[model samples]
Target: MLKFTTNLILLFISVTAFAQDSLSVETAAIDTVQVQQASKDSTVYKQRYGLRVGIDLSKPLRSFLEEDYQGLELLADFRISHNVYIAGALGNEEKTTQEDNYNFTTSGSYLKVGLDWNTYENWYGMENIINLGFRVGASTFSQTLNAYQIYNTNQYWNEIQSGIMGEDMLGEYSGLNALWAEIVLGMKVELFRNVFMGASVRLNYLVNNTQAGNFPNLFIPGFNKVTDGSKFGVGYNYSISYLIPIFKGNKPQKLPSNNQQEQED
Candidate 1:
C-alpha cells in the first residue's frame, strides 16, 4: 500500500509539473505578442514632401560657350503626393542662326506649367527619381530678319537666286507669339544633401503660332526650330536643384503577423 501511495504521489507531481510548463509557455507567447504590438504602435516613419527649385545649367553654359546664344531658365516643383509633383519653368532666350538663304535672330520669354509623375521605385532613404511629365508652354517673342535670298528658278536669263540684305526688308518684327505642348522624360539623382542634378529631354508639338506678317518664324524662343513642313521640335535641359522640406507624411503601415494574430483570435 505504501508503494502504491508513493506511485500515486509521483504521478500527481508529474501532471502538476506538465501543467505548469504549459502555462509558462502560453505566458511567454502572450508576452512576446504584447511586446511586438507595443513596438508597432511606438514606431513611426515619415516621408519628406517639399518644394524643389533650381536653374537650368545647360542654358547658362551654352550662353558662355556660344557667342550668338544667350539663355536662362528657372525650374521649380512642389510635391503634392507620394509620386506626383506640380512643376514648371520660366526662361528667356536669344539666338541667332545663319541659314543658306536667310539669317534670323529670335528673342523671347517663355513659361511652362505641368505635372510630373515619378515612375521609379526607390529604396528607403533614397530620393532618386525617374519621371515622366507633361507641360503646356507659351512664349512671347520677336524676330529680326537679318538677310535672305529670294528663290528665282528662272534660268532663262542666266539669273539664279537673288540675295537681298535683311536691312532692306522689314528689319525687326515684334509682338510675335507661340504656344505648344511637351512630353518630358527625365532622371534626377541626389548628389549631396538636399542637392540634386537632373536631365530631361522634351518632345514638343506646336499648337499655334502667330506669324510675323510676311516673314515666317524660323525659330521660336523656347520652341527651338521651325522647319518648313514640321510642327514637332526637340529640346533638352540639364539642371541642379535644392529641395526644401515643407512637411512630412507618415509611411504606409506594415501588415500584421498572421500566426501571432491567429493565436490571439
Candidate 2:
C-alpha cells in the first residue's frame, strides 16, 4: 500500500509540471507576436514625411516644339502644414532651330513658386506625387533668330518654315520677360527603396507679349512685340525626373502604454 501511494503522488506531480510548462510557452508566444506587430507599425511610420525635393522635365506645347526647346526645373518642397507643400522652382528651356535660311538657338530660365495640395493617401507606391497646384512665375526670356529661313527637316512647323523663307526676321534681341501660369500633373514611382522615377506635364501660357522683329519671325514667349504677320503662342511641357532620398535615420517608437495594461488584464 505504501509503494502504490508513492507512485500515484509522483504521477500527479509530473502532470502538474507539464501543465505549467505549456502555459509558460503559450505566454512567450503571445509576447513575441505583440513585438512583431509593433515592429511592423514602426516600419510603416518611417515612410511618412512632410518634405520632398526633386527635379522636373518639361516639354512645351506645339509652338515650342519646332525650336530646340526643352525645359528642366529644380524644386524645393516644404510641408509648413499637413497635406500641403509650398514650393519654389527654377527652370530653363532651350530652343534651337537650323535651316537653309535661319540657324539659331534660344535658351530661357525662370524662377517659380507654387502650392501643392495632396489628397491622395492610399495610392501605393506613389510617395512622390503631384498634388493639384497653381504656379505663377516670371522668366527672363531671350531668343536669336539668325537666318532668313530655317529648313524644316521633320515638316513639323510649316508655318515657321515659310516665315523664315520670307525673311520676315528683322534681328535677334535680348531683355524680354514674361509672367506665366502653369497647370501641372506629376507623380513618382519607386525604382529602389530610396530612388524614384518621376514625370510631369505642364500647360504654360505667357501673360505678356513682347515681340522682336529683328530676329526670325518665329514665335517666342514674352517676346511678342507685335503681331505683324508673325504668330505668337503658348506651349506644353512633358518632363521626366529622379528623386533620391537623403539623410535617412532610424527612429523606433515604444509600444503603446495601453497595450501593456491590456496584456496584464
Candidate 3:
C-alpha cells in the first residue's frame, strides 16, 4: 500500500511540474498559477473507453465433468453515459481428467449486455458499483457410461416403470448435452484513478436436455421438465479495469485575452 501511495504522489508531482512545460511562462509564476488553478475536478475518474481482463474465482457454466473452478476473460466497454456502458467480451477454459466416463473437457464463451450503477464514490472508502447482466451461450458435456446408466433416477418414469415385471423391468437410455443462460451481479472498487478491481457472482440455468432417442412427450436437461431439482447453480468472477479520459487533462495554459487576464498570465 505504501508503494501505491508513493507512486500516486510522484505522478501528481510530475504532472504538476511538467504541465507548465506546455507554457513559455517563467518558473517562479508556474507554481503560483498551479496553486490557483491546477484542475477544477480533482477527485473523480471518468473515461470514454475501458478495457478489463481478469479471472473467475468460482465455477464456470461449463458441464460438471469439465467445469472450471477458475478461468480468465478479456473485455472492452464503451461508456454511453455517466455510469452506463456497452460491453463485448470473450474467454476460454480447459481441464484434464483421469476417468474416461465423460468427455475430456468442455469450454464456454458468452456475450452480455449489462448495466452499472455507482453506489458510492470514495475510492478508498466504501466505493461500490452495482452491475446487472444477462448472457447467452453454449457449454459442452457428455456421458459415456452405458445405454442405461445403472444409477439413473427419473421421478416421472420411475413411478410408471414400477408396474413393469419380468423382461420389461430392465432397459437402457442415452445421455444428455449442455447449453445455458447466465445472469450476473458484480461490484467494483477504485484502486487507482484509472484502475479498479471487483468481484462478481453469476447464476446459470441449462437450456437443453434431450431425452432417450425420440421418445414422445419426454423431458430432458435443457428440454421438458425431467425433475423438480434446481436447474441452476452459482459461480463467481474477479476483474480489473482501466479508464482513460476523453478530452481533458490539467486545463490548457492560456494567453491574456484582456487586461485582467494579462496580469494573471
Candidate 4:
C-alpha cells in the first residue's frame, strides 16, 4: 500500500510539471504574437503634401480648334492640410461673338482665389480626390465694338449698315472690370507618378461690373456672357497638373487591439 502511494505521488508531480510546461509554452507563444502585432502597428506611411501647378487642358485645346475663341489658363494649388487646399487660376481670354445685329470681341485677364475641400476617402496607397471648392474672382478686361448694324424697328428706310460705327469702335473699352464668385465641383486622379488629371465645373454669380458707355457689357472675360436678366454663368475646365512634393506627413495610426494591449500592460 505504501509503495502504491509513492508511485501515485510521483505520477502526480510529473503530470503537474508537464501541465506547467505546456502553460508556459502557450504564454510565450502568445507574447511573441503580441510583439509582432505591436511592431506592425508601429509602422508609418508618409503622405505627400505640396504645391501643384498646371494648365487648363481644355482651354488650350479649344483655342486650337475654335477660330472665334483663344484662351490660356494656369492653375495652381497648395495643400495646407490632409484634406484642405488653397487654389487659384490665372487666365486670359479673347472671344468673338456674332449676333444678328452685332459682332463684338471681349479680351481680358482674370485671377481667382479659393479653397478646396477633399471629400473622398482614399484607399491604402491611393491619393485621388473628390472636391468641393469656392472662389472669389476678379477680372480686368475690355470689349471692342467690332461691327454692328443699327436695329431699326421701322423698315421704311432700307439703309442698313454692317460695319464699325466709327474710328473709336475697334479699340479696347479701358478700365472695364468685374467681380464674381463661384462654387466648384471637381475630381482629381493621379495618372502617373506625381502627375494628375482633374476636371471641375463652376457655377458663377456676378457680383458687379463696370460697363462702357452707349454699348452694354455683352461679355466679361472670366465671367462669360452677361445675360439679359440673369446674373448666373456656368463654366468648366479640364487640367493636367504636376505635384511638387514639399514635405511628408504621417497619418494617425489605428489603435492596437484592447486585449493585446491589456495583456502587454
TM-score of each: 0.79, 0.51, 0.44, 0.78
**Cand. 1 TM to true fold:** 0.79
Off by over 4 Å in 1: 1-43, 156-168, 253-265
Q: Which of the numbered candidates is closest to the native, going by highest TM-score? A: 1
Expressed as tens digits, the lDDT of each residue in 13-74 for candidate 3 is 99988877756466657887776554532333432334444443333434343533234456
In model 3, what lDDT does residue 181 have? Answer: 67
Shift in Å, residue 83, candidate 1:
0.4
Give per-residue CA lDDT, model 4, range 19-103, as digits (tens). 9999999999999999898877665568899999999999889899999999999999999998999999999999998977668
Clashes of 1: 0
The models' CA-based lDDT, in order, is 0.90, 0.58, 0.47, 0.88
RMSD (Cα, Å) of model 2: 13.0
lDDT of 1 by residue, 75-169 (tens): 99999988999999999999999887778899999999999999997655677899999999999999988777776556676654454344567
Better of 2 and 4 by TM-score: 4
Query: In model 1, what is the error at residue 58, expressed in angstroms?
Result: 0.8
Q: After TM-score superposition, what is the CA distance of residue 140 in candidate 2 from its true location, in Å?
A: 0.5
Q: Order the numbered candidates by lDDT, best leading.
A: 1, 4, 2, 3
Whichever of 2 and 3 has more lDDT, that candidate is 2
